[model samples]
Target: MTMLRDQGIILINKDSEISSAAVVAQVRRLLGMKRVGHCGTLDPFATGVLPVVFGRATAAVPYMSEYDKEYRCRIQLGSSTDTMDREGEIIKQAPENFDASKLEDPSYVEQLLNSFLGEIKQQAPLYSAVKVAGKPLYKYARQGKEVERPWRTVTVHSIKLLGIYHREGFELPCLDVLFSTSKGTYIRSLADSIGSKIGCYAHAAELERTACGPFTLDQTVKTADLFDCFEGLGRDSKAFLSASIDEGIVKATLTAFAGFPTQAVELSDAIKLTHGQEIKVFPDDITLDTVTFTYNNVLLAVAGVNRGLAKVKRVFTDSSAEFLREGSIDEDI
Candidate 1:
């Protein structure tokens, strides 16, 4: 079965019990492409919007990773776990006589959730993919060796309590929360901190990403359905490639650079850009720090403008060679 090396992005509504990498791997296998990658990593137990990029769309991964994410997480109070999630071993439990009703108060819950609305520090959990000294932190955790995890400053754009879930046997509260946060904000860590603030043990019992940047759960193809569609495409390589670019299943690579300023250059200048040459732009045309160069509505390159010179930062070209510069630019800008 042959396929085109066409550039595109696909949003997968990842099912629970699957890692983000696994979703990408499945897409890679179905599409039969070697240059496939995911924009962000989701915990194996967590589900929702996983953006899988293939072909030259892989070049957009770094930029897309900067997108803000939204998630709906369930925080179960009164018992804490080693991994700060449902999958971990229980490490602590609230006292039997603990006042679990305090968490049920909507006003109090509102106050507690409000306290975490802005920038906050979070320590990387031991049972996480975060690397320490060239190895994943989870590796050390499995060996019973404790390591000081790095602290990250992440922002919560908005947060609210969706509803409270009370289990019959469980004495404490389970909070269903919906939040929109900056990239790298861990919902699991946030849930753990909420428990800590309540003076009780807590863990993220469930997590579902509702949105990632511009991609939403509604736009995603469920894993099972995606496979069926791939199979349904049959052996027509052209049809397979065309289906891969469908608006519903796959998005154009340029979508990843949405909100970045765009400058449409002449075909000659676009050709020069693809060759890594910096082109001159007018001062009026260089308002944004970074700009995407295009020709005839197709993306050519993303460049940083300095003193009227548009220097290529990332090249998105029809040519086989796609180039990325060293040192990261601020994608949020």
Candidate 2:
């Protein structure tokens, strides 16, 4: 028989130089599991809080991806890149009429930042991964093929200009910014637009994600540190990787995904949940769009509550028709 898989979310302080897919592959090798999935995609030039879900926790991917994210970015004025970031080719320059002192005034900079707040519409970068006609935009851009990218509406939520700094070799002025934004917002695009709004051209020089919903950089482990732990594992290695792994990454039991608030469900209801049955929900729990059903210290289901009942959206635990029969089930379920 196949053994039960150890599953939970692992937050990695992603290395900016590495692609997100590489991080997932590395984790899969370290734990020897095939079901791992990353909660968000970070560009190779960006790094910080990347949540990797394993086994049963994979059910939480869609729900967790919706959380607002916070990023710390460096915006270099007077220059713009085709990719909207340092990695891309420079394609635009600030108008010569640019006054270096305009950004020196804090109030002017605040106004420029405020313009990004609330709903804003933008065209996705040509080098972006956004798909058009079922093909990634970047793939077309690489071949010198032009595809009309659609304008997407996204919210900045909030923005704060940290400070302006000087880069010795580069001619442009750079601004450090921290902002929380909706899932689809691209910081590089936002940075470039802010520069244009202020009559200066800019591209994202550096980016590091600091937070995503309740998860923060504080809980992440450096990518190198995580892999170094399993450098010598072999037949002689300790059997339990959970006890050996950092942050209980491969632990069977974990805190229910905080992205969706939870509600307690009785034993019978949980058993029925596995079969996708709708169970009665209390009035107070009705307000929750997604409810986690917890019972006996285990997360049994992530449900959608409506019309005074909860319907299973994602079931983590297994249930059998035999168990649903009265007196046929045991407490172990």
TM-score of each: 0.90, 0.88
lDDT by candidate, in order shown = 0.81, 0.77
lDDT of 2 by residue, 21-93 (tens): 8999987777777988887789999989888877787887887788899999999988888999989998888
The list of candidate 1 runs beyond 4 A from truth reads 1-5, 235-238, 284-287, 319-333
The true-structure Cα RMSD of candidate 2 reads: 4.3
Error of 1 at 146 (Å): 1.7
Give the per-residue lDDT digits (tens) of candidate 1, residues 145-249.
989999999999889888887866677879999999998888888988888888887999999999999888988888787667767877444466577665346
Error of 2 at 140 (Å): 0.3
- Please give the TM-score that candidate 2 achieves against the real structure: 0.88
